[model samples]
Target chain A: MTDPNKPASVARRTISTPLILTAILIALALIALASGSRPFNQTVIDIFLRVILVVGLYIFIGNSGVMSFGHIGFTCLGGYAAAWLTMPPMMKQTLLPGLPNWLMQLQLPYWAGALIAALWAALWAAVFGKILLRLSGIAASIATFAMLAMINTIYSNWESVTAATSSVVGIPIVRTIWPYLIAAILSVFIAWAHAISRAGLALRAARDEPTAAAASGVDITKERLIAFVISGAVMGMGGALFAHSIGVVTPDTFYLTLTFTSLSMLVVGGIGSLSGAVLGVVILSSLIQALRWLEAGVTVGSTTFGIPNGLQEITLGIVMIVILAFRPSGIMANSELIWPRARPEKPDEMSGTTPTQQGVTK
Target chain B: MQTLFDALSLGSLYALGALGIALIFGVMRLVNFAHGDVISFSVFALLWPSTDAVALVFAGDLPWFLLIPFVLLMGAGLSVLCELIIFRRFRGANPATMMIASFALGFVIRYFLLMLFSSRPKSISLLPALSQPVEILGARIPLLQVITIVATIAILFALTAFLKRTRFGLEMRAAAENFTMARMLGVRANRVIMGAFALSGALAAAIGLILASQTGTADIQMGGAVMLMAFIATVIGGLGSLPGAVLAGFLLGAASVVMQTLLPIDARPFRDAFVYGAVILVLIFRPQGLIAAPGTKERV
Candidate 1:
């Protein structure tokens, strides 16, 4: 393991990746702010939230090369933690009487609550990842899912504390897109930072050539755990903002549908690239919104036409299948979106170098 | 006696579901998430599409002999069609991509059903005669329960015989064991894979029929819980092992029933938490599963 700081190549590689990511975030934020309509603003907020969640997913699934079905468990935890911290004291006393005196009485501002939520979610991720990361491949996937099921079951049935299956209301709503925009930008930077770190390079190496990487002294488990915890924290923050957006939190909100939707965005974009994660959310979210508008009916000169309800989902599914069938590695195919270079190089070379290690040797 | 009967009945459903999942997984490493939707689709096929709470029985009105075969064929046809249209293109994709594709396909099927049936649970009295209780040794059980168990065993034995005695079965087994080698050996890859899909589809239909008869309702989500249990069974039994899947399915079903019956009344709602906890423990201890199939080891 060479020092990341010693190489000029590593510094150049690190700068470009984050620069590209920050540029994209700025473009999205500008568009969100430029849009005047409340509905459009809300839509942007949703997309930004999704971007955070998917980017969080990329930290682990991308680098570690493991598909997790359980990251939603962290989201659930974050949502609840935010709810507990931000909900009105009176309402908490009535709705969730089982909370300890401090939690029952405490009422924090949204930013503070969200920060606490992220830490709370990350703490649990560390514990669960410690146990589950030992198993690799499909077995790890199932274990994560089981963890999600466990979280869902307890949240759904713990009536006195979590309001069981019922929605917990009275959390302060933040309709302004700026907070979400900032959070989304922060999340992307965090993801970029992790992806450029020495740990990220080692994790990717382990994912691609586990036996070789292990023989070379990479601690695969530790690398995976680090990615998992970082991803978990990002997901938690996304979940907290999600609660603020909707002003309500239910266990079901953070369950299978959310999990699959985020996973699909990540895969459709290019599961292996940070640029893919951002673009995937932007593209898919736009497509869904467009379809939804069509479902609401579109006027064509003389008459109005509309797709029947439910066709949107079917269309989305077909689109996903077609995309996967055509480009199985995803839209980006493990390559970052880079500015056009003066000299063209081999595709393998571009994709092979870690985003952080791109020019270190040169 | 009652408790044993209860466990067996539940186990029979799970075993059947696991067998369907295992068969497909053996041939292709796909975990076919759409299987639950296929079960829902089969039951919905019996009724004329309607939004009413009371189902308008269409093919369901036919004699049991005709109705059963028709439903089975529908399931098999749809399953085969999915393979041809969707799974065929994903044959060479990574397992994660294929799994997501299958999940997307399931979402399509579910929403399609939702559009037709309006998401309401529809009641249909199929094989109402099976609803009666009869003496089984010292334990009285619903005729449907007894039929479910017996039918499961019969299917298992028949499938075992088919896999052992037939040329097609031998090809499928060989393909499952080592697809590339089997293909090189001149087993027609398409035919063997199609056969697995067809059989898996028919089994889904069987579970659908049994569920429709016992529960007396055809809800869009009826198959979800069963499909999830079957999926877990497939994993814990051994990813590509047929007998392992069936065994694990029964074990899981038995665990669920026993937990339900034995847990304190106040703790009853948390029964699933305990079951999932047990699942985590099992996975931690036996990551390769209770029965590790040959050549399925993780590369690292």
Candidate 2:
């Protein structure tokens, strides 16, 4: 068992995991840049944005062992916040006439808009988390999902403010990949920092051994709230970047499709480990890109053949099911990817208690 | 009178859906997110696969008696296939894993439908006779609405009697209460589970048929909104309580209809927001649900 009191070794291992993961991300970005294809660069940017979202998911889900379906609501909030702040004044006036005079008049830089978006998302997380974190297990999961539905419903129908289901465009488009790459790296570091923090360790301890942790005076709800707020902020930043990347924000975009995609990536990678979060994104995003290329058409000598449209999603679903059926704990299981020499002596200790064991014991 | 009838009719759909979800969750602790896709798949099974704008009706054109059973069988068949191929392997997996697997299964089913029919909603008129309005106690309502409410009540009673009096139903209830214990006592685990899946799938089909006939359209996503409401109903009712699931489903349906009628036209579109907000508040007050079942409580 990994002891929270053993800070020295835990801290050392934590630093290495984030460093190795960040290096891999940087290497992939460099390769994508070297490819010299605009579409490929866009794909790389998408992968980075996904990285931030999945890693943000990891901070709460991996540590707290709670499956939250509402975090994407924060992304919805963040995306709209970015769009509200960054869209030109004239466009905002016509598209979102419900905006107050100051917001209607103001247009901020991307970074500033993302900052406000993050804060806005975190604010809601704190409020919702206070009420939601009290419920544990399936109840908590359902509550979070309800929260998402509420957010989506409001955004989808509040016509003047959110443009009600229609896409709100005219935000500046960001084609460059560097900003996304940096944001992803920053998200990874933040997740790593949270994982090694007192609250994260307490939350994990509570997750793995709730009765014992509670006996030892761990406030499970408080730790969960902390993780929730931090993850909400990270998800918010990713959402803001997503708005800039696509040059449009819509309620449905942040609804079920995005929620499930980010979640599937996180779970397929390994829900319990940060390395799994990052690797899951890289592998799955690459698979999707490759599939899309085939769907567009693949050349064999002179003749061209293309996979039928919509086969990509079907294939992706099958792949995910196959993976989960075989490796229930996910590809990385619970262990972080580190240099072989840096791996701990006891493998089980590094991975902590597998979720299955915890499940059975509970 | 009109509002009361509308609420009952809408409630019938949700109640059926909640029952399907609750049954599976009781036995396996798995929240089958694919239940929605099962609904969609059953509806699409009525039409031949085509990219054309107009749906080519196949089984949908059958007489009402045959049509109902055909759709139910399709739902049961697909659901059973899913159990054999996918869910059976996840028997001992954690809840999160099982949930995600089911979700992936739903995704595959949904995309399969999308690929076949394209995303466009297909219009199909089924049981045109039932669409005509009938006066009942000074209120005018469609005959199909009356049938829906009556069918729901009949099914609920039949299910109740089956569980109370039949051997297989007894075994199912036993397994649901305590699967390992029931298994040790010689209940065939696989049989019981497969039966639950079959029943749940049939329920999904029933909902699909009603929705397809009432809306006069065979949209790929027709089942999604109802499924969501049903899932929430299952949660608010009690994880493993059948009666509670039914009751909560009705309550949710009534809540939705009431919101639709009472809210001003400007606020009508935001009705779902209020309903979901109420869901959060209910969860806060009753985390274990309104009627807690024996095995659902968390010790720690």
Q: Model 2: which residue pairs collide?
A: none
lDDT of 1 by residue, A1-362 (tens): 34555545544544566567767777877886787788888998899999999999999999899999999899999999999999999999989999999999999999999999999999999999999999898889988988999999999999989999999998899998888888988998898778767788888888877877787778999999999999999999998999999999999999989999999999999999988999899989999999999999999998889999999998999899899899998898788776556116444555424533433211
Error of 2 at A110 (Å): 0.3
TM-score for each prediction?
0.97, 0.97
Q: What's the distance in Å from true for residue B78, model 2?
A: 0.7
Cα lDDT tens digits for candidate 1, B118-176: 88999999999998999978778898888999999999999999999999999999999
For all candidates, the clash counts are 2, 0
- On residues A1-362, what C-alpha lDDT tens digit does candidate 2 reach at each position? 34545444556655778888989999988998899899889899999999999999999999999999999999999999999999999999899999999999999999999999999999999999999999988889989999999999999989889999999999999898899999999999999878767777778878889888787778889999999999999999999999999999989999988989999999999899999999999999999999999999999999999999889989999999999999998899888777776545645555433332333224
Docking class of 1: high
Off by over 4 Å in 1: A1-11, A342-348, A355-362
Worst 10 residues of 1 chain A by lDDT: A353-362
Q: Which run of 10 residues does model 2 chain B get worst, by summed lDDT?
A: B291-300
TM-score of 2: 0.97
